[model samples]
Target: MSNEQENPLLQYIFNNPEEFARNLTKIAENSGKALAAYLEPRESGRVQDETPEELSLAVKTLAQVGEYWMKDPARAIEAQTRLWTGYMHVWNNTLKRMAGEDSAPTITPAPGDKRFRDAEWEENQFFDFVKQMYLQTTQWAEHLVEGATDVDEHTRHKAAFYVRQITNAMAPSNFILTNPELLRETMTSNGENLVKGMEMLAEDIKAGNGEVKLRQSDPSSFEIGKNVANTPGKVIAQNDVCQLIQYEPQTEQVYKRPILVVPPWINKYYILDLNEEKSFIRWMVEQGHTVFVISWVNPDERQSQKSFEHYMQEGIFMALDTIQKTTQQSTVNAIGYCVGGTLLAIALAYMAKTGQKDRVATVTFLTTQVDFVHSGDLRVFVDEEQIKLLEDRMNKQGYLDGSKMATAFNMLRSNDLIWPYVINNYIRGKEPFPFDLLFWNSDATRLPAANHSFYLRNCYLTNNLAKGELEIDGIKIDLKDVEIPVYNLATREDHIAPAISVLEGSHCFGGPVEYVLAGSGHIAGVVNPPHKNKYQYWTNDGLHRDINDWLNTAEEHPGSWWPHWQEWITDKDNTLVKARKPGARRVKILEDAPGSYVKVRL
Candidate 1:
């Protein structure tokens, strides 16, 4: 044996290679046996054994689809004729443009499409043909989905989604011949752009292990407590899971009840406190409300054993205790965002079950979901097979890498989030511009194996949380037990947490609920500031079981939802008291706002 001190596992394998190989073979044999047993019944030609009535129903459905298409033969013929005519016109226009005889084309790129923005795209015949072909293909796909009268709505929706993905993937801009900017760069740089791009590709491969780095900003440029998360405050408490940050009051008098923000640990907490101008934390403080945020640690292998219960205990529960003690308040308003909101909901249920209902004054959820039935496109990736694959990977690493999780999220919006950066950085050979939101997005945090696995299995796969089967520290939680008044906000275009899912989550609570639908996606909706005069929101006092009914009956307001939230939260008690400084006599200050934990990177 080698002199090196081998670990027990390695030592055994080294000493008994034959035995290890035999054992491995046996394990594979067992797995194959299990798989065969599972698949045997499924592959037994069950469909072939269907009764005559079932066969007839299947045939009838096919016939109905054919008849529906045939019924509109004349209209379809007309549409086909128009399409051919348009194609011919495009061809003729392209020839004329090439010959320098026409200023305008018969067909043009659609509005908001930056792909064909370069003059060469319209001026060059080959490029114009490519763009026209792509546009026509997408239009045809959309028309097919829209005109399918006999197909079920679900099938049509799924077909449209896949078709869109296909079209996006095959975009001409993704290639060199059709991309004018890329072609120009190649020529002007004498292939230096390609060399530079290769270097960038190599760097990204080394940094991300084959995953592309999409964000345009330099992370080092932005420092915590300097440029980002600069809101003046102090860390009142610290633990292995989280640090409680108490912001300095901007006003002399503040609300008696403080507000605690529970941001998701999946990302850094500085998202809410990006800078002085855009910081939601600063805005909350300036509004004369004492604000406290939980900055979760960027966990690694050392914290691999941490569970969701650990987060509940050392994160929200600990923060709440510190807030109550520091402010000398019996109850306080609490807010949770995304996954943090999910945690907060569970915490509230646990408290209610333990007869601590009076600990929280009001609960606010921002783009959060308690029910996962319609959790949007993300649900498609959560299943027995997928979870098992993920678990195997997590088991090896001790924690789920943030970059891997980020890649999955990026794929959800591949056209917007993934392809754009690929084209800009790899094809065009340009660096991404520094944007605060994108910078914050690139800063992701790892999830400990124990906590992540439990969350995925219990909440996602089995949906135990919604079913009231989710347990933390041996206590089962039921959202219905949460009797406090609730405020829920959902974004209209959020694919991560669908608006309907958020609305459905509100139904879980027994108490009165106020729900608002804000414009934009998950992060943008919550970070919306009133002064910018951007994005509208919808509000309805009544909570209806049907999401559409609520949307239809709701009143639309053209402004940020922050003012509305302020009105709702402050309406209960308008009384203001003298502002209390950070780190009261009870709890000593640990560090400044955006504290040490938030600064830790993977």
Candidate 2:
């Protein structure tokens, strides 16, 4: 018998044909059920029909794009020919190498392309061909996406994204045969790495409730207070939803108006207070600002019912009241990061509608989006079907698990976040290095189901927040009603909150709005300190409706935007006073900074 026929499992299956048939039948039945579930349309009243006017507009847009592309048919043919020629050269080189040629034509990886970095991939002719072919395929796919004119911009973008994902997934480095490092280790260790990987996989499956958990690092390697959120502070106030942390002043004197930082609950609050060097909180404190951050509690089933209104009231409102009372300052300057910025804007609107606009002196938004129309790739996951699936999962768990949410974000940059860790941990049998940022990233926090659902539906899906249709606590909050001077900071490379979307939202406010575009992605842009002397920023006094017009006219400023922000905040008021301690008369110290709420693990 042949090797395949002699296999014990195969022989048994062949002999017990009825049993094999039964198993196949069961598999088919399960697959059909899964397919049915996936195709099922969600029940949502917000979904609109494709009207003739909308269809006409879409058709016109497609035609315009098509006409532009078809203006030069020869150009398209030339590009395709070039790609074909490159593929042919690669195939010829591969065949030559197979015929035992000493030298083979190989393409070098692009700058910063870490995949195919293994010596075997670079030296081995087979792997060299595989890498070159993959690169060529990716280039061709991207060219096709760029050339496509039959679809809308969003559709084209999604197609490109999926194409990249498929190409990345099929990279030779992910396989055992093409992965030199993995092969070397397997031979040296006599397949021990495989056994260890299996063990780890089993352990993770058990711990993660059947989910395949790709551990970024050894969780025990880092602790909350010691290496991570080590900044000195005290929790002066606490509520059901969050705890207010008041960091000890570094300088003798601080700004007269205390700064209240509202961070997104989607992540742990300590991201701002990470380490002293990279910590924005530390930098702000050293810059003579009395900073108070809201540490949102890691919600459990009990807090799943907490609504968006509850977060605004019990979180931001409570913190603001505490800061005002403690510092004895009627108005405090507020800075909001990410979703926290969105919440702050809502609060400002609510306060304005309620005739309490003076509660905040000035507002600063760090990569926040109120206008969801151009919110970037995250919109792909906000549709009715996806939202329904997410809602159902959240309903079952009472809250959205941090890992589950992280998966969606990680998929946005799968090449960077997912594949590297997979190769290092499982394929190469190595643990990820103890990086604080990665550690913090892995330590995600859960979102309360009610609040998350409301946010996804109202803000992202319907985009009521920017339109002033968002109502909270029996009050209609309008962004135009917010008369407070706003400092809107957006990152050029931000995927979550696009700068254009931020610019649109900034225009919604009926006040003096200064929009600044900083370099780098979301987190790095906001946390950047001036001393690092990294990442330039752009600014313009003119407020133009067109984003490109503003970008074209804006003056480029070197280094970090921190100094500019400091100057802006300082210009707000000339009053400076001795720095106040962590807790004041009204708000006594409860616990040290970083706070208990931030340390909670879901």
Per-residue CA lDDT of candidate 1, range 1-602, in tens?
54324432231123444554554454455445444544444477421221354344334544544455567888668667766877887778777777778557665667777667877676456777888877876786577666776777544544555556668889898886667666665544445455545555555644553344555566667777898889999998998899999999899999999999999988988888888878888999999999999999999888899998899889988988888788888788999999999999999999999988888989999999899988887765566756786787778768998987786677688777778887777656677787888888888789999989898888778889999999888999999998888889999999999999999999999898899999999999889888988899999978987889999899999979999999999987778999989978668998777788887775
lDDT of 2 by residue, 392-456 (tens): 77787689888777877887888888888777765565667887777878778899999999899
Off by over 4 Å in 2: 1-89, 96-111, 119-123, 139-159
lDDT over C-alpha atoms for residue 251 of model 1: 99
Q: Which parts of model 1 are misplaced by more than 4 Å?
A: 1-111, 135-167
TM-score of each: 0.79, 0.82
| Clash count of each predicted structure | 0, 1
Q: What lDDT would candidate 2 get against the real structure?
A: 0.80
lDDT of 1 at 553: 96
Q: Report lDDT per candidate.
A: 0.79, 0.80
lDDT of model number 1: 0.79
